[model samples]
Target chain A: MTTVHTAASAVSAVSAASAAEEKVDTCASEAAHPPPVARGGYTISEVVSHTGLSAHTLRWYERIGLMPNVSRSHTGQRRYSEADLGWLSLVGKLRLTGMPVADMVRYAELVREGEHTFAERQHLLTRHRENVRQHIAELQDTLAVLDFKIEHYADARRASERV
Target chain B: MTTVHTAASAVSAVSAASAAEEKVDTCASEAAHPPPVARGGYTISEVVSHTGLSAHTLRWYERIGLMPNVSRSHTGQRRYSEADLGWLSLVGKLRLTGMPVADMVRYAELVREGEHTFAERQHLLTRHRENVRQHIAELQDTLAVLDFKIEHYADARRASERV
Candidate 1:
């Protein structure tokens, strides 16, 4: 009976692993186009082209301690692997949302600790989401103001033309 | 005929000024209620209390040249006037919207040049608005990811608890 139970558990473990593998595959395809940084390492220029970020800004981000130390080729040039690109894509998303460099550094610290700090990472992200939500609401407010101003100016132009 | 036209324009100007003066009177009422600081001058402590910002942070911001030179009283203490507070409020709003200190300084330069730079100021603000709009869109994208992650974790939590 113990042997049979062990066999059943072994079957469950295999099935779980297979399901997780499938999820990973699906995620790989669904994440982005161009297959996510391709296979091997890419040069800094290649990375810049693929990522749509300027090389100087990328360097500045690295120098400001915003990005982790990238891997280097034997010739001392930066070589970004697939994982590094994925990480950068996430960082880009965060930055595009106007997350401060200091806050991102703190998040990066949590990420470097691995899965043990998942709760903290989640909390930080949630807080940032709240901030973003408030910002979006404010933007909507300002967009309304802009639309009003634009219309008012257009009316003034129309009146001036008539004169 | 010219006198009549000039008289009509003068009357219109007086009405406009009266409307503006009434609005200011309304603002002064709110500004003075339980007044945040004394009428003549405010110490650094008063500024900190009213702004809900730390003294160290305030000094750091000023030291980093983010703030203008604050006026000093005869006792060598910072003396903040109502104009200073008003300017600080605008700065706070810009900072909350993630405008960099450097960019704020650029905007301030245009402001200090007065109405001669009105077109430049408008251009800067228009560009900043576009940046903010893009930032908001990126945040919406991240918010979607966060919602997915939160739901995934919540489901996992329930599944584990069930076991």
Candidate 2:
């Protein structure tokens, strides 16, 4: 549960300039011209609630260099911007693909490293995409097996009733 | 690694009658008329390679009553049948769906309980099928994110080169 007013007031207490809105996509497509609160940002607990990631995991992501540069409040609390949330949203999806955390960290490093790593990042993502496709196919194949077994069981039940 | 000759000879040494080849789908469709070795069955090592499950896991399946009727050799070595392999194959597929082992064990129980549990088993499988589909959907969504990021990087690279 998050208290929006309290979080916003905390964000207000931090005197930082608004992050420049550029079309430059760092990790994901951020909200265009975010509100002062959106740009000023969310607290760690707010981020935890919004992303369904624990505070520890958020901290760990920063520690492992899996996260981009996160701004801090005047009191030194981490203040996550809309762009950070956008990046986190991408990371959340990546986690679902079961990609190795190390690979994700590498991708983050590449992003932080700049456009020179574009080709390498694309290659890594393409390979993971292939893996996800294969994983889906495997699950689809099992659905057929489950269907076959279910149908057979239904037939067996009917035959038993007749006897 | 599975040795066809040594494993076959080892199987034939066991004095088990040919498994009846009725089209009765207990777990899965079996090879109608298996050769003497196929009927007599494969050694645990052979099954390990075939199913990609460890020997410890195979034995654990037996211990937990997750296995169907697995026959034994003269020296008490497990002889996995074609039907047994079929069942194990299905089990392997179920594991890929990320279904809990307890749930899988329950499905095994329903199968072992006979035709009376047909409806319940079907319901359980149908639910699992839904979960698998949703999981696939989630992965597919992530693919789009990966595509967006990759394309953005490619564009950024081109821009940087032009400058």
Candidate 3:
């Protein structure tokens, strides 16, 4: 009975490995011919072109824990998956709003901690959105000031020309 | 004729000095009783409070030629005039729009060069205004993405709770 149980365990392990291998095969085919949305894997340069981020910034993001651990090729070069590209895209947007690097790292940690941190992640993003709103309002006020000053300059120029 | 010229020059000098003293008296009275709009001369600390800038930053502005040479008191302390405060206010607004310090210094120089630089200053401000507009549009787009992600998190939380 003990021998039969051991055989059954071996069979289950083999089945799991086979399933993983099948998934890898699908990934391999996708990697060979990348889609427009970047489903499979990409090189560092490919990611740079796709995301418009410099290679230095990308490496810095990885070092700062703003990015998840990227996969590696057999020769030990970095390989970025589609999921990585998606994360980078989000990071790029967050950066444009001048979100602090530390806050971005915290958000990344929440992402890696799984689905339970969703609520907390939402709260972080909501707070940042409010900040962005305030910044937009301030810029609008500055714009109004610029408009007034520009008109004043126009009048001054005309007056000088008349003189 | 030399004696007459000397007497006339001395009289003119005394008249100019007296006028300046009278202006200082008015400024001293205003400084003694600070107003809401902050006219007259202000001490370093007073300017700090009014502009919400640190004393260090104010000095740095002067050092970098971003500000004109502020008037000095008898004790060699900085004394900011109403015109200086007005210039600082405009600088504060420009800083908010992320204008570079070098560009601001250039603008300050143009102001000091008299009325001839009006067209150039106006051009610089107009270009900066365009940049601000683009920034605002990009931020609005990012805000939309944040809204979408926040909603997704909400739905995910609800789904998990049901499970």
Candidate 4:
């Protein structure tokens, strides 16, 4: 009876060990598939292709110090981490919103200095959003002008046909 | 009857002349309303306040030869005509669409030479539209990433609350 009881305990121990091993394997897999925040990094060429900005513009952006100090490979090629891409993606938005490059450089400077300028950054972004809103309004107006021109030509064509 | 008819005809002719003169007065009033597109033209300062572009940028655009030469005032200040404003409006569109100032200068040269380069102008504008389209796509993607990040932070907040 004592021998049987000891065997039962040993078997349960082995099963627990197997279960623990399985749990570790699951954890390993989970580590490999981290959330969005866990992206390893990206290279400059990758960034250029992804962002659709020219290599020259990228270099120019760095030269103007609009970009943060980027890491480099042993070969001296710029290496970008996920954080860098996140920052650049914001820069892209600012550029699209028509913030001048000079103004963007100033904004970048503020960003590099850290969270003390959060209010300033937020203010700048809010101002830019307003500007973009105004720009879209202007674009809508011009688009109406274009529509009128198109209709004018179409009407003239119809009139010529009638003649 | 002939004398009566002659008098009546003279009176009719005078009435018709007066009607024509009234039409001319209406045209003249309309012309004077805007002063025939300001033949005396605008100074650099006037263009600045009118267009909301900086005076320095306007001069730089001219100096870079992206803008057509404007007539100079007797005091040698730059005088811009209505046509210049129209052209500048086009330039603003190109600039807003992310065409480099240098490329715009080339385009301006093509334009100054007249209608022979219509195809080239179309090509340039078409290419720029493509660029803008690509930029828009990239911005959409970046916006998605930003949304993701913002959501992640929100989720983290929720998770902390659960904890």
DockQ of each: 0.13, 0.30, 0.28, 0.05
Query: Which of the numbered candidates is closest to the native, going by highest TM-score?
Result: 3
lDDT of 2 by residue, A17-128 (tens): 1122224333543577653354456789877766667799889999999886888988898988766776776666666666777888999998788767888998898888
For residues A9-92, write the lDDT of model 1, one tens digit per residue.
Answer: 222222222223211322344334555334325687876766666688678877866667677766788776655656666666
Model 1 CA deviation exceeding 4 Å by range: A1-45, A52-84, A98-121, A135-163, B1-39, B54-76
For model 4, residues B1-163, the per-residue Cα lDDT tens digits are 0011112222223223323332222133444454323435677876776556678978898899987688887778787776677677666655544467777898899879875565566566555555555544534443443454345445655666698
Model 3 interface DockQ:
0.28
Ten-residue stretch with the least lDDT total in model 4 chain A: A1-10
Interface RMSD of each: 19.1, 8.6, 21.1, 25.9
lDDT string, candidate 3, B8-52, tens digits = 222323223333433333433454656523442578887776666
Instruction: Report the error of model 2 at residue B45, Å.
Output: 1.8
Clashing pairs in 1: none
The candidate scoring highest on lDDT is 3
- Model 1: residue B124 alpha-carbon error in angstroms: 2.0
Model 3 chain A TM-score equals 0.73
Q: After superposition, how far is residue B126 of candidate 4 from its true place, in Å?
A: 0.7
Candidate 3: where are CA atoms >4 Å away?
A1-40, B1-40, B158-163
lDDT of 1: 0.58
Model 2 chain B worst lDDT window (10 residues) = B1-10
For each model in turn, which proportion of the native inter-chain contacts is also found?
A: 0.21, 0.52, 0.68, 0.03
Clashes of 1: 0
Two-way lDDT contest, 2 vs 3, winner = 3
Candidate 4 segments exceeding 4 Å error: A1-163, B1-39, B144-163
